[model samples]
Target: MAKVFIYPATSLILSDLVARFGHEPLGAALSIRERIQTPGLESPPLQITPEDPKKGLRYAAVEVPSGVRGRMAIYGPLLEQSEAAIIVTDAEMAFGCMGCARTNELILFSLRQRGIPLLELTYPKSEEEGVQFVKAIREFLAGLQEGGS
Candidate 1:
């Protein structure tokens, strides 16, 4: 089965579809819940590793660019572990993380750099679009089953 990373990670629809298709969904909520429930953790932006500062910082401490690194700390691992990715844009309308513009750029850039099999979609507005959205997702995931680039 493929490890499919879903952007926003908290969407009921996407997660359900991925699981229904027999893939693991790497969602943001999963990451957040793991971090929050980990023993001894109090808050977010926790250190990924001891701060080196020379390399980019991953903790929620520190201030731009680096803050991006901090926030990405929570997210980057999920990205790295994925065999494929499904990113939904215009998700803010659906109460998903629109995230920082720069972070969006970074995430998209990193995904492209990794050259994984990727499915990019716009969140649906109406019933017809929703059908097309699911169709696209189903096709992409089925392609993964068949073997992907």
Candidate 2:
């Protein structure tokens, strides 16, 4: 199965759709879960270790904001692992909010640079558009399954 990275990384709907279509969804929920469940992560609410920022430096420059670096620490690895990706633009906060414009820009840039099988979709405003949105995603994913990249 292809490892598909969903943009926003926090969109449960996109994550579920990717998995339902028989691909592995690489997103923040799974990554954060690994941090939370891992032993020796002493910071409760922060859910980060000292090494997390260091890990992020691999993807982002040291001059970048620490918050962006921290976020990259989580998303960078997923980007590297992705065999394909689905990016939903203009999404509502309820859908998934990465909460940092700089980080968002960086993530999108990184994904584009990777040259993976990528599907870019706009967030649907109506039920009809929603149907088409999902159809497009399903078709793209199906193409990946058939060795289309």
What's the lDDT for all of these models?
Answer: 0.67, 0.82
Kindly provide the TM-score of model 2 when superposed on the true structure, using C-alpha atoms.
0.85
Candidate 2 stretches greater than 4 Å from native:
30-46, 146-148
- Candidate 2, residues 56-131, lDDT tens digits: the string is 8998899998878887888898888899999999988667766678989999999999888999999999999999
Worst 10 residues of 1 by lDDT: 34-43
Spell out the clash pairs found in candidate 2.
none
TM-score of every model versus the real structure: 0.71, 0.85
Give the number of the best model, judged by lDDT.
Answer: 2
**Backbone clashes, each candidate:** 3, 0
Name the lDDT of candidate 2: 0.82
